[model samples]
Target: MISTTVAAVVTRFAPSPTGQLHAGHAFSAIRAHDFARERGGRFLLRIEDIDPGRSRAVFVKGIEDDLRWLGLGWDGEVVHQSARFEAYRGALGALGSAGLLYPCFCTRADIAQAASAPHGPEGLFYPGTCRALDPAVRERRMESEPHAWRIAMDKAVEQTGRLHWHDEETGEVTADPLRFGDVVLARKDAPASYHLAVTVDDAWQRVTDVVRGADLFEATHIHRLLQALLGLPTPRYHHHPLLTDAGGERLAKRRGSESLANLRENGADPAALAEALRRGEMPAL
Candidate 1:
């Protein structure tokens, strides 16, 4: 029965299966979960397993186990990016039909050597090298070599015009899609790039509030643009501060920091560990 009460608040905790969960992940997950529960909302869990090169089954299992140990549970079945390839492909096609997508044949080295290439928030922004390629040339190269599909940022922005999204942490923010240059939508090895997949999935899943780390604050600008392009509703964002080490370095998996699994194995109490994490008292180092 549709109670017709106020719509339920929806949140999500999306983690990639690249490495074992760490202190930072614990804090983020607990925060998202608690935020939703406190408001009688539903919290979702998404497995960002799009990057086949780095994602692993073991890490996926470890994420669930660590979250459980921290006393966090999500509503509904977990959504896996690997299982949503067709949807991503459709989104790409939609953008392509709108003349907002193009193929790029340049490798990372080629972009680095391009004398006129401009730098943006994400490393060297892609110069529109293939954006003006002869159709025959592009077709030939695409059939013979690897390439990534990138959004025609200028064209896409022109279509959307001036746009803005609200962020709970910073209030209304103007969209700056061009700041990322012509961001990739799909890659050679992967059907969809991180930007494409995330925007498509979030809208599909009806995520109301995005709660994640502050490191992704800049990326939100691109996300706002994608939402406008795809004709999807925008959700509020909350970029929380990251958990840091004793030396003030941020805790991260790639840095080889201790994992939640190791902490559990070392006799860390789940309830107590959760409390300490909430209070920012854990990880004395």
Candidate 2:
């Protein structure tokens, strides 16, 4: 269990094994590492390879190597999301038992075609077609057709009342999880969605501080709600500014941003790169 004491800090650098570590990843990792180390706390590494279709073992190895080369070592054994299916199952079961979860059988195209579909932080919010389904129909579909599990946002919020989380940069902020309408907790193809897995991981690992890019700031609202629902602790957060390239585009794997391995292969100095990232400065690319 994580200490609730204000002095003990625990931070983690979680990376998905779907791509190489780019400069933005380096910056995020460095921030988490420095935060924990400077506070004489524990720093952890977590592998979010829950998406089996896109995750690769080779990418996992590359992640560790890149972090090592950057001189950011972690504490204890690394946590892998794929290995925690049973835990996620338990979390889902608890929420399901509470009647706060519903089967969502809507496909992406189905949602996109809905004229009434609303937009949210993640994209087009789920139209909630299956939210009020007949119990018999939901049971029949569960036994036959594959379906994702979505949290009943209204019910969950009612149970948890008002919620909030502290951000190191922004101070206290109110949570608005309803922005993502009926967000999926367990995906049809995966055991758990990003929101569920991440919430469970942080609580299980006893993370006291969450450090990541600003892009995930909105997701924190949903996470805070989950923590309340699951009786988990709400950790302090630091959503650092995203690192961008010369053209002002944020470094992303899908955008083919230069990877740390590429920089190493090109004879760039790892020490110098680490120093630049530590100083909140982008190294020469």
For model 1 the TM-score comes to 0.95
Query: lDDT of each prediction vs. the true structure?
Result: 0.88, 0.92
TM-score each candidate: 0.95, 0.97
lDDT of 1 at 193: 89
Q: Tell me how candidate 1 scores on lDDT.
A: 0.88
Stretches of candidate 2 exceeding 4 Å from the true structure: 1-7
Question: How displaced is residue 143 in candidate 2, in Å?
Answer: 1.0
Write the residue-wise lDDT of candidate 1 on 50-116 in tens digits.
9998999999999999998888999999999999999999888989999998899888999999998
Alpha carbon lDDT of residue 195, candidate 2?
A: 96
